[model samples]
Target: MKYDKKEPETMDADPMRLLVSAILAFTVMLFINGFVGSMGGFPAFVAFTLVFFRIRTRAGMGNGGMQQELSDRQITGRLLWKYAAGYLVLWGILRIAFLISRVTGWGNINGASAVEYVRQMWNTSLLEKWAYFFAGMIMFAFVLSLFPLAVIREKVRWIRYALVDGAVFALVCLGNNGVCRLKFEQKSSGGATCLIDHLLLCGRMRTWQEITCLLAMVVFILVIGAFVFSYASRQYAVKNIDGIPASAGEEESRRHRMIRKIVTVGCSIAAIVIVVVIVLLMPKDTAGDYTKVAEFLTEDTRMGPMEYGDVVYVSVNEEADLEKNGIAQGYLAERGERCDSRFYQLAIANLLYTDPTGKTNLVQTAGTDGGTYAPVASVETDKTWETDDVFLLWDEDWALESAYSHEPTGYVACPADLIQGLRMQFPDVTYRTADFSDYDAYFTLRGYQNMEQALEEDPVDGDWVGCILVKDNKFYFGSYENQITGICLQQLRKVLGGNAK
Candidate 1:
C-alpha cells in the first residue's frame, strides 16, 4: 500500500512543539554550562536528547504515525539507538573542534608555528574544546530532531533539515572556537582598534589570521541570515499538520531478524569486555603500603632492577609545572602514601654543622597527606667520621658548580628539627659531603641542558642529583643512594658498629 505524495501525510504532534522544546532545552543547557563547566553539559544534553526523541518516536504516535504500529517499549528501544547515534555525532563534532585547537596550539602562550606545533603535539594529548560542548548543543538538538523523521517518504528532505540545523550549530560554535581567539604571544593593541572589538583578537592577528577571522565571521553571518530568510519564507519551521512522514507510515522489514541477531551479539561482546576491564581496574584494597626507601635510591634503578617500592617520587615542581621533568619530588613523599616524598632536605641538613655556606634552610614542608611533617632520623651524631664517609653532591645543587666544590664539603645551616619527619629511616652510617673533584676523572657526565640549568640556578632544591660515595684512598667511587641496598646498608652499620657477628 503506497501513500501518494500530496503533502506527504501527517501526525497530530505539535509542529511548533519541537521548536519550543529546543529553545527551552538549549536555554537551560547554556545557562547551566557556566556553573558546571563543559563536562556538566552531558547530562543536560542527555536530558534534552531523551525529551526531543520521545516526541517523534513515541509520544506523537497516538495521533497518527507509522511508529503507532510498535508498542511503547519497542518505540523506546528504537529511540535509545537513535539517541546513542546522535550522541556519537555530537561527540565527534566536539572532538574535531578540540583537535583543531590542539594541532594549532590554541591558548598556549609558547605556541610555535603550525608544523612544529603539530609535530610536538601529535603524540602528546588531546584536550577538550569546551565551545562545542557548550554551543554545539543547538546543532545536536537539530541532529536529534532528524532521527525520528528517518522513515519519512521524502527521506531526502531530512538532508535539507540537517543542512540548516548544522549551519546554525556551526555558526554558534564559531564564536567560542580557538579560531575566534588570539593565540600567539603578540601584544594586543586593544580590541577597539579593529572595526569589531577584539572578536578573535582582530587587534593582534597577523594578516593571515585577520583574513581567516573575517572570512569566518562573514560566512557565519551569511549562514545565519540564510536561516532567518528560510524561516521567514515559510520554507522551514513553519509547517502544516501533515501525514505521518515523521514516523508517519508503518512498514514491514525482511531484515529485522538479521539486524536483531547482530545487535544482540555486538552487545554481548561489549558487555563482556566492559566487565573484564572494570574488574582489572579495581584497586587491591587489601595490599599494604610499605615502602623501602632503598628501592629507588639508584643512579638508575633499571641497571639492576629493584621491585622498587610503591613510593614513586614525582617532582614537586613537576606536579606544579607540567613542562619540567619530575625528578625533584623526592623531598616530600609521605611514608605510607603512594609516591613517597623525602631525602632532599634530610640529606642536606645531615651535611656539616658549621660550614655556613649551604643553600638549604630547613623549611617546614607540608606533606601530601595533609599532615605536619617530622624528621624520622636525626642528623646529630657525637661519633666522629674516622672512617671519612665522603659524598659528592649536585643540586640536580648550585654548590656543584662552585670553587668550594673542589674542597672538602661541609654541611651548614642544618635544622635541629626537620619536616614531615623525613620518612626515610637509614641505619646509623655517619657521612659528610665531599666535592665531585674526587671523581671528575672516572664519572660519565650526561645531564640534560634543562637539568643542569635548573640545578645551577637553585641551591636548596638539591634532590635532582644522587649522592656519590668516595672511599678517598684510591678514587674508588660509587653512588651511596643508588648502589646501596637495604642488605648492604645493614652490613655497613654492623661493621661500623664493630659487631661483625
Candidate 2:
C-alpha cells in the first residue's frame, strides 16, 4: 500500500506480539529457572533480554507477519532447548536423587529415619502432583525432540536450531562450562557468567512470599516491551510513508530519539531493580540439595566420601505442610533466627514426636576430638526432641562437669539425668564425645570443606545439612560418627510425644 502525498503514514505497532513474547519468556524462565533451578536459568534470563531486542528490531524491519514467523522459531529454539530441557534434566536428577537417597542411602541402615524422610519429603500430595506434572511435561518435551527425527527433512532445522541455541546458552551462561558448583567460599568464582547467575537466578519456591522474584521478572518484561512498542511504531512511520516533507521526517525521528532515551532510562531503572531483587532473593547455595550426597554416601570414596565429593545442591522445595513438619512457625522456642546450628537443631526438635510439645533444656557436651575442645552452652531453650535435642556427654561426671564457656549467663542446665535416661534407653549404641567435627565431617564428606569453613564463609542459613548420615548403630554422644548437624538425632527422637526436660 502507498501513502498520500501530504502527511506521513503511520504503521501500527504489534503490541500483542511483544506482550505475547514477554509472557512466553517469563513462563519459560519460571519453569526452567524458578522452580527447577538448573544452570540454564541465567542463560534463559539473558535470552529474555535478547528476545525483546529481536522482536522490536524484526517488527520495525518487517512488512506484515514476517516478524512473528522467524522470531517464533527463535523462541522455540531458545526456550525449549536452552531453558526447558536443561532444567528438565537437573530437576529430574534432584527428584530421583531424593527418592534414591531415601530408599538406598539412609534407608539401608536407618530404617526409622528412612520412613521419616520419605513421609516428610512427600508431605503434600497436591504439590507432589504438580511436581509430577512438571516431570511429565519434561518427558514429553524430550520425546518431542525425537519426533522430528521420524520425519527428518520436515522439522530437522527446528531441532538443529534448538541444539545450536542450547550450545550457545551453555557457553554464555556457564562461561563455556565453568560453573562454580554449589559451594560458596565468600569469594566470587571470578567470571562473567558467575556474576550473572549470582544476579539473575530466581529464588526457589519455599514460602509463598518468594513470588517477589516473579514480580521482578514481570517488571523486566514490561519495561522491555514498552521500548519495543515505541521503537516499532516509529520505524513503521518512517518506512511506510513516502513523499513526505524532510522536516516532518526529521521531526518524527527526533521524537523517536527522545522516546528511546526515556525508555532507556526507564529500562535501566527496571534492570537495576531486577538485579537487586535477584540478588536479594536468589538461592545463595545448593545446600538444600542432598540428592547427590545422599546417593553417593552409599558408595566408598578416596577420603571416605569427602574426597572429590560434589555436594552442591538445589532446594527440595515445597509451599505446604510448613507446620506439620515442625517448621516451628508459631511455636515458642529458641530463637533460631541467627544461629545456623540452632536453626537445624530446632527444626529437627520441632519435628520430634517427644519434643514436639515439650520445653527443652539440654546441654551440648563434648570431651575431646571435637573443636577448640570447648563446649557450647547447655540447651536451655524452649526446644525439645523425641527424647532429647542433641546429646554429647555420656558419662555422668562429664554431663555434670561444670563448663566455663557459654552464652550470656555463663551457666548451663546440665542434663545429667537426661543423659543417663538416654543411655539407659539405648545401651548398645556406644557413644562418643561430639563436637563441631561431627557436623564438619558431614559437610566435608559432601565437599563443603568443613563446619568451621562453612560457618566462616556462608554462615547459618538455608539447608545446613542435606541428608543425615546413618551410623551402623553407633551414637557419638547424641549424634553419630561422620555426623555434622544433629539431623541424626531423629533416630532417637522417632517416638517423641512429650517434653524431654
Candidate 3:
C-alpha cells in the first residue's frame, strides 16, 4: 500500500490586506489612548492585543488558514501573559529612557530634568504638546509592530509593516492634534477643567465660531469611524463567517466559561467606577457674595474722609460676574423707573450681570423675548490698589469700549491735574481716557443702531454702566443698573470733596 503525498502548506494572505489591518488596529489603539488620557496605556495595550489576535486568526494562523481552533482557555491565558509581560517590559524601557534623558539630555529633554521638561511642555501650545506625545507613540508602535508581525505565518517584508505603521502614526497625530487645537482655541479660558469640558462638549458654545468648530469635530469623528470600518472589513473577512473549533468533539470547558464571565463582570465594574470618579472630579462654579464685602468697605470710613488732594482710585473684581441675588435685585429695584418694561429688566439682568448660577429668571425671559446681548470682554487690572470698591452703577455702554480701546477720547470725571497725579503713582499702568463724544461711533459699530431698540423699551436717562474709577491715587470698581449712579457719585463726592463736579 502506498501513502498519498501531502501538498505543501503555502502562505496565501495578501500583504496589502495585512498592512491595512495593522494600520486600522493601531489607529483605534491611539484613539483609546487619547480619550482616556495619560494613564490610558493599559487599556490601549489590552485593546491592541485583542485586535492583533483577531487579525492573526483571520489571516489563518491557528487553524491552517481556515479558523482559530485553539482551546479558549489556552488562547486567553497565553495572550494575557504575553501581553502583560510585554507591557511591563516596555514600561521599564520607557522609564529607563526617561531617566537617561534627564541625566544626559539625550533625547527631547529641554530643561534641567525630565520633570521640568514635562512642565514646560504643559505650558506650551496644545498642538506642540500633542506633537511631542505622538512622537513618543511612534517609537512605542515600532516596538509593538514586531509582536503582530511574528504571529502571522506569512513571510511578509518588514518594510511593508514599517510603511503601514508610519501611515497610522501620521493619521492619528494629525487628526487628534488638529481637532483638539481647534476646540482649545475657541475656549474663553484655559485650564485642565476647561480642556476636559471642551473635549466632552460640556461647556456652553457661546459664539458662531465655537458652534462651527463643534460641528466640524462631529463630522471629523464620523468620517474617521467610516474609514476605520471600511478598511477593517476589507482587510479581515471575519464578518458573516464562523471559525472552526479545535476538534469535532471539543467544547469550551466550564472553567474557561467562568473565567470569561469574571472578566466581563470586572470590566463592567471598572467602567462604572471610572464614570463615578470623573463626575466627582468635575469642577463646580460658586457664585461669590460680595454684598457683605462691599458693606464692610463702605462702613470703614476710618480711612478718614477722602480728600480730592488724596487720589481715590477704585476698581471692582472683574473676574467674577455680578451675581443676581439680593444685591443685584436691590440695584435693579432702584432703577425700576428707568426700566419701565420687563424686557429692559431682562436685558439688564442677562447682559450686565454675571450670574454664576448659569440660569436666572431674567435669562429665561430674555431667551424668549427675542433680544440679544453683546458679549463682554474680560479686562484685567492691577489688584493692589487699597480703595477698590464693588457696587453696581450704570454709565454709558460705550464707556467699556472706550476704556478697552486705550485711546484718550472720553471725558473722565477726575480733573486732568488729579488724573496726572494718580498716573504718577502707577507709572507702569497704561490708562485710556475717553469723553462722551468719542463713544458715538463706537456705539453704532457695536449694534446700538437705534438706542431705543438697543436699550430699554421705554427711553431711559442712561444705559447701565460698570466701571473702574481712578481719582487722584485711588481706584473704585463697581457694577449696577442706572440708579446706582447717584450713590456711586455720593461716595465719589466724599472722596473728591469740592473737586467732584
All candidates: TM-score: 0.27, 0.25, 0.25
List model 3 lDDT by residue over 179-288, tens digit each: 55565443322222322222332223446755565465456545543444343333232211222222325687999978866765565555445534544653442111
Per-residue alpha-carbon lDDT of model 2 for 1-501, expressed as tens digits? Answer: 333445322233646545644554554454344323342344444454344434333323323223343332343333324333444455456556656765776534444356665665465334334333333433223222322221112123323433433333223334311322343332332211222233222213354433553354455445433433343233333343232322444545778978866765565555445444544544444322221111112111111111011221112111322233321221111211211221122122222111243342111111110001001121112112223333221111211222322211111222334434443443333222233123321211111222342223222111211122334433333335333224324433332222222
Instruction: Give the alpha-carbon lDDT of every model.
Output: 0.33, 0.31, 0.34
Between prediction 1 and prediction 2, which has the larger TM-score? 1
What's model 3's lDDT at 75?
Answer: 39
**lDDT score of residue 332 within candidate 1:** 29
Looking at candidate 3, the ten consecutive residues that score lowest on lDDT are 300-309
In model 1, which regions exceed 4 Å deviation? 1-50, 53-154, 167-175, 184-241, 244-309, 312-412, 415-460, 463-501
Q: Which candidate's TM-score is highest?
A: 1
Model 1: ten consecutive residues of lowest lDDT: 346-355
lDDT of 1: 0.33
Better of 1 and 2 by lDDT: 1
